[model samples]
Target: MARFTIGYRTVKTALGAAVSIFLAQLLQLDFFVSAGIITILCISITKRDSLKISGERIVACLIGLLYATLIFELLGYHAVSIAILFLLFIPSAVSVGAKKGIVTSAVLILHVYTVGEASAALWINELALLGIGIGVALIMNLYMPNAERDLLWDQVKVEDCFRTIWKEYAKYLKEGDSSWDGKEITTASTLLSDGKSKALRNIDNHYLRYDDYFYHYFAMREKQFDVLESILPFISTFGDTVIQGEKMAEFMEELSEAVSPGNTAGYFLIRLDELREEIKEMPLPQTREEFEVRSGLFYILHELEEYLTIKKMFKPDPKRTHNVSGKRLTRDLNKKGSKK
Candidate 1:
C-alpha cells in the first residue's frame, strides 16, 4: 500500500469542506452535503486558480438553475427533459469557459429537479449553498505557505551545479579525459525545469501584482545551460591537451568560481579577449593533432563568451533579498557585491 501523508492542500480541503457543510446546514439549506463537495472541488493549488474556478462554478450554477427551471417545468420534469437540458447546457457552459464547473452545475440542476419546482425560495437556497461553499474555499486558500525561501534555495543549488559542471569541464581540458559521469548536467537540467515550474506557480499565487523575478532567473540559467551543453561536444573532441588547453582550463576554473547570479561576466569577457589574443600570438602548431586541439579550445572559448554574455544581460530584481552563501545578493553583483 502507498503511504499517505496530509499536506497543506489536503488539510485545507478537509477543513474547507467541513466549514462549508456546517455553514450550509446552519442556514438550513437543502442538499447541504453538496456544499462540502463544492468546497472540495474549488480548492486549488493557487489562489488565483481557486478564485477563477469559483467564479465559473457560481456563474455556471446560476445558468444551470435557469435552464433547469425552464426545461423541467416546460417538459414536465421528464428524463428526456434532463437529457435535452444537458445537450443545450453543455454547449452553453463550454462557450462561456465554465466547462470546469459542468459537473458542479449538473448537481445543482438535479437538486432543482428533486425539489420539483422553480420557486424563488428554491433558487435562493441553492445560491446560499453555492456562496457558502465557494466563500469557505477562498478563505481557506488565503494562507498559502511562503515559497520564496524554497525558491532562493533552488537558485543556490542551480548555481552550485553550474560551478561543479564548469570545474568538470576544466578537468577535462587540463587532462585528456576524466572519470566524471556527467550527472551534474542532468541534475542542472532537472533543477532548472523544476525551478521554472515552481516560479510559475508562485506567479499564479500573486494575482493582483506582477512577480516574474524567479521565473526570469531560471530562464536565464536555462539559456546559459544551453551554452554549456554546446561546449560539451567540443570538450569531448579533445584527446590531448595543448598549451592553449592549459590556459583555457585556468579560465574555466575561474569561471566555475564565478557562477553566482552576479554580473562578473564583463570582467571575464575582457579576460577572455586577452586570452584569445595571447593564444593567437603563440607559435603555430607543429602537427595537425595540435592544430585540431587548438581549434577546439578556441571554439570552447567562443561558447564561454556567449555563456558569460547571457549572464551579463540578466537583471535580477533589486528589491529581492535572496542570499547566496549567507550573504545578501545586491542589485548588481558585478558592480556592487562581487569580488571581481
Candidate 2:
C-alpha cells in the first residue's frame, strides 16, 4: 500500500484556497467559492510556472469579459451564443499564447453568463475574484521549499552509481567473465535522469538569477555516461586477459576512485597519457586473440580518456565546493553502511 502523506503542494493549495474563499466572502463577492477554485488551479509545482500561468489567466479572463460583454449584448445570451463565443475566443486565446488560461477564463465567463448581464459592477466583482485568487496563489508559491538539499542527495546517488559502474568496468577487465550483472549502468542512467530533472526544477525555482550550474554538471556527466556505454562492447569482447588488459584495469581502478565532482581530470589525463605511451612500448601480441584483446583495451583506454577530457573541459561553480564535500561525506557513510 502506498503511504498517505500531505505534500507541501497540498498544504499550500489547502491554505491558499481557504484564504481566498474567506477573503472573497468577507468582501461579499458573488460566487466566492470560485475564488478558492481559482487559487487551487493557479497553484503549480514551480514558482515560475505559477506566475506565468497566473498572468496568462488574468489576461484571458479580461479578454473573456470583453468578448462576453459584446456577444451577450448582441446575441441575446443564448446557449448557442455561448458556443459561438467559445469558438471565437478559443482561437483568439490560442493565437495569443493564452491557451493555458482557457479553463480559468471559461469559469469567469460562466459567472458573467449566470448574472445575465455585462454590467460594470459585475466585471468589477469578477476582477476582484481574479485578483484574490491569483494574488493568494502567487503568495503561496513564493515559499517553495528549498530544493538544494534534495538535489545534493541526488548528486551523491548519481556519483556513487558512476563510481560503481567504473569499478565494474575495472573488474571485467581484470577478471573476464565475472558475475557482475551490469546493474550499476542501468542504475546510473536512472539516477542521472532523475538528478537532471531535479536540477532543472532547481533552476526553475530561481526566476531572475538562474543557477544552471547543477544542470550543466548533470549534462556533462550524461555525456560521460554515453562514453561509458560505448566502452561496454569492448569490455565484452575480451575473451582472454592480456598484459595490457591488466594495466588498463589498474587505470580503470584509478579512474573509478577519482570519480568525483572535482577538477582532478587533468591529473588523470597525465597519468592516462603516460599509460598510453607505456602500452605502445610493450611487445607485439603473439596470437590473433591476444591482438584483439589488446586492441579492445586501447579502445577502452581511448574512451576513458574522452571521459576524463569531458570532465576536464567542464568547470563547476566555486561556491558549491562545500556542498560537494558534504555530498561526498554522505556517500562515504552510505558506502560503509552497505558494506556492513
Candidate 3:
C-alpha cells in the first residue's frame, strides 16, 4: 500500500501532462499545458520529493512528439519505413522496456503522426491532447498518489507468497485422504512452487526500491524470504510424507477392522492412532540439534495425524511473522497456539 501510492502518482503525473498538452493545442491556447504543469508541481510538492514520475512524463512528451514527426515528415529517408521503425524501437524497448524509454516514445509519436494532420492547429491540437491526457491522470489520482510503484508491487508479490504457501499446506493435507488422487496434489504443488519462484522476483525489486530509504530493510526482507524459501521445498516434502503416513494409517485401520476376530492384525488401528498423534505436535528446534531433528522429522511426519492436526489447528497468519526477530508485518486473524 505504501509503494502503490508512489507508483500510481508517477503514472498519473505523466498522463496528466499528456492530456494537458493535447487540450492546450485543441483549445488554441496554453491553458491546458499550464494547468497540467501546475498539477505536476502540486503533486511533486505533496509527495515530498518522493515521486519521480515527472522524468517519465518529460521523456514521454518529447519522445511522442519526436516519433510522430520522424515517421510522418521529419525522417523522409527513402530506404524503408520498416527499417527506421525497427532501429527506433528495438534498442529503446531493450534498454528500458519501452515504457519511459525511447522505443515506446517513438511508437506513440508514430501513432499521432499516422492519425493525420500537421497544420499549426493540428500541432497545437496534438500538444493539447498530450497535456490533457496527462492532466486528467494527475487530477483523478490527485488524492491517492503512488510515490512508490515498485515498492508496492513488491508488497503485492510478497502477499501472494503467503497465499501460495497456505494453499500448498492445504494440498499436502489433501494427500492424506484415503481416496486422494495425486493430480490435485501435483497441481497444488506446481502452483505453490510457481508462486514462490515469482515471489523472489519481487524481493530484488523491493530491495532496489526501498533499500535507499530504510537501512537494513531490504536485508531483513531478503533473510526472511530466504527462510521462507527453504520452507517451501520442505513443505512439499512434508506434505507428501503426510499423505503416505495417513494412507498407511487408514490401511491399517481397515485391515484391523476387517480381521474377523481377535488377532494380531486387529492391533493395526491402535498403532495408526498412535502414529497420528506424533505428527500433530511437530517441534520447531529450539537448539541446533532440535532444529536438525525436527527438520528431518518433518519429511516423515506430514503423513501423520499429529502433523495434520497441528497444521489444521495452526494456520499461518498473514498478519504475523513466525520465528523472526525485528520488524515484520502482522495479521489480524485469530492466532492458533504456537506449533514450535
Best by TM-score: 2
Q: What is the TM-score of each candidate against the true structure?
A: 0.91, 0.93, 0.32
- Per-residue lDDT of model 2, residues 68-137, tens digit only: 9999889977898899899999988888888888999999999889999999999999999999999999
Tens-place lDDT digits, model 1, residues 1-340: 9898889999999999999999899988899999999999999999999999999998899889999999998997878999999999999999999998898999999998988998999998889888888999999999887787668767877887888898888888788667999998999999899999999889889868878889999999999999999999888877655445888889889888777765688999999999899888878889898888888878887898889888889986766634353223323343442554
Q: Please, what are the lDDT tens digits per residue for candidate 3 over residues 1-340? A: 5554556557767776666666665776633445455345435433212123434554554655654466656555334654675576555544543344343244344444555543466556545544454446445444542323333333334434433433444445446333323343344334445444443433333313432321122333334334434444544444334543344334433432321111222244356466546655544446664454355444433333332232233223243223321123222111211331
- RMSD values for the candidates in order, in angstroms, are 4.8, 3.4, 15.4
Model 2's alpha-carbon lDDT is 0.85
Candidate 2, residue 72: CA error in Å? 0.4
Candidate 1 matches the true fold with a TM-score of 0.91
Worst ten-residue run, lDDT, model 2? 319-328
Clashes of 3: 52
Model 2 TM: 0.93
